[model samples]
Target: MNKSIETMWKQGFISEGELVVPKVNDLYNRKSQNLVDKLQHMFAVNIKAIVIGALLLLVVMSLIGAPWLGIYICILLAPLVLMARQELDKSYNLSKGQSSLEYLESFNAWLHDSITRYAIYYKFFYPLFYVGMVSQGLASDAGTRVMARLLKTYPTDYVFLDIPGYVWALITVLLLVVIKYSAALYRLDLNMIYGRQFKKLEELIKDMRALKPE
Candidate 1:
């Protein structure tokens, strides 16, 4: 429905006497707009889900007497909210004067940049989040009681900072592995969440590109 796309459609009809080219162009234009709209809707839903999920977790954590853990997780998640807002603003501000193909391409580029940016954050965030959860759990009252029992059962030589040295070693190894694969893990998560939309977007872009006039 973009004015530029409308103009392109008119031009295509004028240049080519056959209706096939124009009709195909029109079909792709509609598909492109629909796909973009769907993507925007999905993005908004994802943001809402994050906020709702965070609030629910906060409530659960408070009820469980680990409100600080919930607060820490929310703090960690704050940047994600800002990032999504920035990306959503960018999506809204994408130039409307361009043709459908250009618009879709711009969105596709934005998607890639968004994913890369998130991936970079994930590399650090995943590890920090794990560490936060573990550290917070070990600092809680329940953790103190558990640690006390462990101390009574195990030799002090095998304990470090009230936790078994082996547990610390395992945590360290897990953190290292998470940091190394965090981006890949994020991609997998994203794929699981939006795999169908992603595939459709790719196919739409491919079709639009093929239909583009030389």
Candidate 2:
């Protein structure tokens, strides 16, 4: 039994003369274990999803004659898989013998640090992903035809990096827009996936803290 939970029991959460409350203690233990278990499960699932998604993207891109772009996407996603694995390992290796409160605190700290690091990675990732997709599309046969049509109708006298100035400007603006909002986008994504679990963890920690001695 965790010391914090033991303390909680001693502090009147259970009967006055009783040393233990099977029902209450079990409830807290179950909740704590459940939260940690869910987090680990989610991490495992996320890694699998990324791998499957990457493989599917590679296959689809190959069929569409953009194998390089597919490979590039996989390369971009590789770090994410590695990061997730690191997080999963960390979660598994949380300090032994910690009180429930201390354990939760440790997990919370890990979560915060992981999110901060991912925020930085996403700043570059979102923009790069956008650029890769756009560039790949433009290099495709249909995009080539469209570009030819545009160049024919509009003068190509001014060019940048072999692209018509106007087209290049549009791409640049879009890329900048994606980069500007990448952090927010990452937050939104993170929340969508883990918001419920995060909330539960925080609430559990708060409840545990309230039970501590003054």
Name model 1 segments beyond 4 Å from true: 1-20, 149-156
lDDT, candidate 2, at 89: 81
lDDT tens digits, residues 108-154, model 2? 99989989888999999999999899988888888888887888889
Candidate 1 on 125-157: residue-level lDDT in tens? 898899889888789988888888877787567
lDDT for model 1, please.
0.78
Evaluated with lDDT, which candidate comes out highest?
2
TM-score of 2: 0.85
Off by over 4 Å in 2: 1-23
Candidates' C-alpha lDDT: 0.78, 0.80
